[model samples]
Target chain A: MDPQKTGFDYSTFNPSYFQHLEQRIKDLDALGIQADLILFHPYDSWGFARMGQAMDKHYIQYIVARLASYKNIWWSLANEYDLMAQLGQKPLSAWDFIGKTVHQEDPSGHLLSIHNFYDPPVHKGTTKNWFDYTKPWITHLSIQSDNVFFVPKWLDDFQKPIIFDECRYEGNIEFGWGDNSAKGMVDSFYRIVLRGGYATHGETYIDKPNTTRPIWWAHGGILRGESQKRITYLKQLLATNGFNYVNPMAVQGPHWELAVGESPDKQHVFAYIGDNQPEFEIFDFLPKDNIYSAQVIDTWNMTSTKLNERIDKNHYFHIPRKPYQAILLTKIN
Target chain B: MDPQKTGFDYSTFNPSYFQHLEQRIKDLDALGIQADLILFHPYDSWGFARMGQAMDKHYIQYIVARLASYKNIWWSLANEYDLMAQLGQKPLSAWDFIGKTVHQEDPSGHLLSIHNFYDPPVHKGTTKNWFDYTKPWITHLSIQSDNVFFVPKWLDDFQKPIIFDECRYEGNIEFGWGDNSAKGMVDSFYRIVLRGGYATHGETYIDKPNTTRPIWWAHGGILRGESQKRITYLKQLLATNGFNYVNPMAVQGPHWELAVGESPDKQHVFAYIGDNQPEFEIFDFLPKDNIYSAQVIDTWNMTSTKLNERIDKNHYFHIPRKPYQAILLTKIN
Candidate 1:
């Protein structure tokens, strides 16, 4: 069981670890949740992160063989792969080998990705610090950035399911990565989802009196933040509308400041104006021939109100001039 | 005077225009205000923006000769000079010539700068869209960007007085540049000023019912936004504390998420936690020898409360988990 022992010693491998993972995956599957497992992380003081390439590949193979059969499994090679590489604990070649081993060994062909640590400098909607997500073994992008505005550009470049796995957390913790307010977290979630990407939520509220209790971000515990109900509302709205994917609207008017997304069929459009509270917005991009039933949604309050008057391309939809307001447009004919 | 006319004909020069400008400058001087005179702009239906290089130079000479005597005048060569250049109405050389002409004609040597339209791509804290403020004739950097986070870098690069003349406006207008909320405007001002720069406030609240009234941003009429009082509070706070310039703190702990600034003498520090609501923060970066009195400021509500306990390097400051809160530390011993 010693991590310092590099070569794969099957005789010494623990069966209880596999059993725990299998049970967890089964429970998550029953709950209709995807279990995004991190195979490596730099927050370890042990020698496991420093395991040689051969041992790493063997470990990946063993995990894939044991847990890849679960329908809910998503393979995250590392929490912060860049940090591991920077620390010289693992090289880029080792990550590639691990990814290839996981891909080859997994019969289920589950979602495979690696999370990044270096937040690439975004200039004119371009970045270079991402772990070449274009690689053959990488199935999708697992990003760690606060700039969800780049989701549209990433969708264009990668053409894959991009998940901002870590856009900080909703909490009152002291660290920068874990102290975002509930409203900020909800705003980020809507921004990411409406721009044709996905976001993962985490909570890091420090437990008072009994400060030793595990936080929801690191260890499973009670959800203390208020973003969960709003996120559920967003999910229900999208699912009820039968919208599987919504790309950013192509027009360049309100879309410059608003996160406006249209379904591939072009029948449903959702625009989230996060902070701006314009009194009325003209949707000149909507087809002139189509009539739309507009609904103003209060994202924070989890309420949707249907407008009495139908709207066309020529008309402006009057809004209540409030923050965290979203407008949903459904074509009537 | 016809805007289409090219050369500066003394016979046709309008004395009334000069008289009006003189009166306005005098009025502003009496009110202890600096009149930032924009000599050229692209929002023109007339041919004045299309004036030839000679006429542009002549106009600059005339304006500078007439207005330079006033102590409260700042020569902004053009509003969005880049837009004028992009329109092919004026070239870069023409701007350089105009800037040089203004510098030569203004014997009083008032503050001289040019605004830009191109929102530069900021990557790793570097931008290229700014007009060359390095030129000796330009006294300061007049910027038109919404990102006040880059003020520290801009201060480092330009080493000139930086004023974000248009970080959007405080209003509910339809335009993106004029639709920021009052809280957002106040946040931008603190972010700019804390990083050792300045910000100018503009309001674009559309007057309901009386829709034809001039907005404060373009044509000054009445200020309707709630940000003005908060900005005045900020100005009074800085002035009362005798803080001329406070650069962003060099250390990178809480400063990563918080806008923390320190006076050049290192005796005073101001930290603005814009959206984060951390319950407490540990300031280990402060000098261990200095004893300081700390005050928690509710920036939006315009209230300040002093903490009874003096803090040195070893203590953690307990804070209420709230948004738009700022902390001020002043040396007492």
Candidate 2:
């Protein structure tokens, strides 16, 4: 796969690659998708993973220089840098060079994070002090575990945005990390959001034996999964409502998760309950003296129904019998 | 109200109380249910939770003296003992006294453990060095979290028997800890067993508003939940198949959990695939040289079907498309 040794010198600096990437970014931007541009990944066998320091630095500069103008582009240093280290393939100095080069060259200072692999010695990358949240170059925390319980710890540690980049894919593949039912994927999405974080979507449905090689998880082509439509609904809701003000609140139940968003003037209270029927009372979390018109939101169906009765801290309203439900309490003033 | 303050001088030493408890133990023993007799609990409002040290010591001795004769009696010093300390109701010395008194007085030396409640100052009880597994009084570790991922950590920490006595009850109660669905409860049961630990079962389905106050969780009554049947199936399978020798094995997938069990003669391999439709290759975990007959076990439905084909490391077999499937490979010598 080394074209340089064959006297062709096929490099990432080729003008055709950026032209294609630029077109892809524009197409994604039109669809309201942010391009998470992973500059270096360890999956390649073409000697691209173990590139020399000088070539790596030049490649990072060229990529960032071309893509930094787009507002929708995010700079991901590598797909699984820890895995690269575990293979005894790359050195920390090379990763530092690439990260620093990307951070310094990109004028937009777009969101930057590195994806991680699970279990050590592959997980040793994030344990280093240089990967600390104090580092200004890294914009957010990107993790690849189904353990959402670590969300709070990372939130407190980083004090930055948390992105669950890989929380298992919605597909019927053989591998554990990639095979999740549509319902399971949807539950993970709600969990990440309720924990005050962002989640990435991926699918790996094996179309046939040898035909499904370029899957959505690796190649990123057509999304032939059910979660996309539901995620779009959530995205639209977040965009329409005051989602920026929302914060994850400590909930008492083991199965239930809660998030509250209220304006400074306290006109509305948005509470999101996750993965359980809302049969319990949320009256204590509501304002004591205000009469509020409440609406129960069926998350899966993406429908909201208004109640005829007014609710206050003293009153209890019936929560619909469903797996996942939310209530929006708005001050009627 | 305390009868002692009311001039009646009622104590735990009442012969009538012992007679009733003895009868209850005999009944439980007949039914093969080991009674986890909690001598002290924080929920008691009848002055039982805040008994003085002398009275508590006497209570523990009298209770153990009568109950130790039964083969099925296990001493649990307190239910949520940490919660008692958190409420500023009981001191650590009192707990130490009760634990020590029970361990010394009980001649049967039945399994002894202590249950812990979560959150701080309630969680502070186990943080002390006295609660360390090295303490001879504590025979096992009792925990109450849905995080089965911590099972390995506790296993390593205690080096003793680990019993997940309360990993949330199966019910629709308002409290988060007591309201897991039957399916969720069953999954937790598998997780506990796969991790080489013991789990306890309890039911909390609300019968009515005020009329059904005697829940199976608190007062002993008729069991009213769906998980009992499934748990019984698992119990019988484990009992017949020598599941005690099995250990949790490291699995690569995010959704899949694997446990391997082999008979004394190495004639059988029981691989438990948890929480995923088993579609992958189990060839690597199979004994490469031996031909084995495989059966797919549907844990929820409690059914096992034998496949016509024999399996080895080279051959892949079809697994049914469903969550929570297990495969048993017995040596076809």
Candidate 3:
């Protein structure tokens, strides 16, 4: 990418760029971080994004040849592919060609996806559903959405794994996408997870003037945000007691936000209350003999407290006086 | 409401209830708060919501007879009418009757609306758009939505004045609908406003155990939250320079969230940037002869610093490193 910046000159292909990427991946592996590699992006000051189809094919092949062996690598065909089209640079067919190229050439079968963003004038009338999720080359849907409400529909529409790759970052940077608070970031993480999808974490902290370097979002560097720690806590919670195995159940009635993830036998129930709701009665839809133990989870504070000793029939729970609260119910054997 | 809690008993209606209501209206007038009176709500422990059609008509007529004279009153047919139906007490026909009765009986012709909520099982497959904005009895759409993204669509769908009556209260309450933070509340308020809709503010802070009383959202004692002052600031911003009069311009291309409000002559341009957005060149879209003076409005902190002396074409202004930041452009002759 560095050498080809002047133009898509094949003569400028230096092995050092791949060496640096390989080294970075190894470092990321050390920290147990999965690297979602973007092969082409319009964030280019370089001419790499405007390369001809042949050059694009050459670059895609080169990237796969160098980095396909890594277990943590994911192939994001392009970052904001829609933005590129909006800028009148690359068209969808180019992305299709590049994606097919990556899918065919990568023998290790690293997960393939393409990042998308809203075209400007984000008002409601101008907004369009731009992504083709059913593409055979796409392994999963990677999205950057302004709202989380539409995620469920996308989940149902595509019937594939959905990843909230960009739900705004946690930082005080000069961009809206990177200025979300740690609490907001974690809240989105839980919201997506509760709704039967996944979300990724990024940080973009701006330090004292001229001291800001190696932003965690763009430039690979040390993590300096609070969300990662809380996300670690969430990851721990998901892995424990086989909690990660459950999928969100079909909810009916007025409490539309009461997103519940239940195990097959209905033994474990994780209910996420997104915002503050008034007092309501929660019916135990579990088996007749099952006595459910419910605990209040303060998601932001990462604390779990026992709410009730046993709930048999309908139980009245005064939801916490806070946002991002959840009720974790594990049935007593 | 307290005395008639047993049922819509006409015998229980006393002169003292009207006297108390008149005094409350006077008190609300003193505080400059327009009263949104609920004719019926599902929160009643009393049988008011389950009244027969005849009793419902009687109650509606009584309410109109007593309170319709107040100029500040807005009739809310019921709080979460669909919720009442889901509770198996009141049906939609009952709500339709109540709404029509309120519409016909009230001589003052105060704004009439009905509140709605989401049904549970938060997935997109189950989410239903239940509000009939086109109803003849309805004055405007009164909505309680979890996501603010739908506001623009609602504005378009109904083509009537939209009020986000309950877009989640700002508090740490155990309910997701009432536990939003002051910052989140203000952000939503601005978001709704920029998108050509109105939002209301409420608070529900629960103090230490057993000491909590008079929730600002329910009981309405005193203003205990921070959003009111910020909302006042927003109201002031809207009032100043007639900024509230402009509708958001149609945005095209990559910057989907550039919510703009401009004067009729295209002289005064108000652009709000929510969250941290990556850099984009802000072009001077006004007339050629006019010299535009730009200032950065820090919506959260209430600061407006002079940004540019004059912006012509392709102006590059780095947005503030914060959420809810705005760039206010005024034409200086």
Choose the strongest candidate by lDDT.
1
lDDT of each: 0.79, 0.68, 0.71
Write model 3 residue lDDT over B1-333, tens digit each, in one string: 243566445535777978999889878978888998887777877677776788778777887998888878898888888877877768876777778788899887899998886532352322254557688878898877655555555666788888888887876543446557777788788777776778888887766323447577668777877878888887787778676455654333334445656666666777777654434334544456767888888888888899845765554445544556777788888
Off by over 4 Å in 1: A1-12, A92-94, A118-126, A208-210, A250-257, B1-12, B118-126, B208-210, B254-256
TM-score per prediction, in order, is 0.91, 0.87, 0.71
Error of 2 at B242 (Å): 3.4
Worst 10 residues of 2 chain B by lDDT: B120-129
User: Tens digits of per-residue lDDT for model 1 on B1-333?
Assistant: 245463545335698989997998898888888999998888866667877777777777777888888889999989988778778777767888888888888888999999988432122223566788999999899988776766666677788989989888888766567778999899998888887888999887774423677677667756878999999998888877767777776334333457778877777888788888788677666776888899998999999999777877777667888899988999988
Docking class of 2: acceptable
Model 2 whole-model lDDT (C-alpha atoms): 0.68
Q: Write the per-residue lDDT of candidate 2 for residues B8-62, one digit (tens) a residue.
A: 3425367896899889889988988898888777876567666677767767777
List each candidate's DockQ score: 0.40, 0.31, 0.21
Interface RMSD of 3: 6.4
Better lDDT candidate (1, 2): 1
A130-246: candidate 1 lDDT, tens digit per residue: 688988989999988777776777788898889999887898776667788889999998888988899999888884423687677667757878998899999998888867877
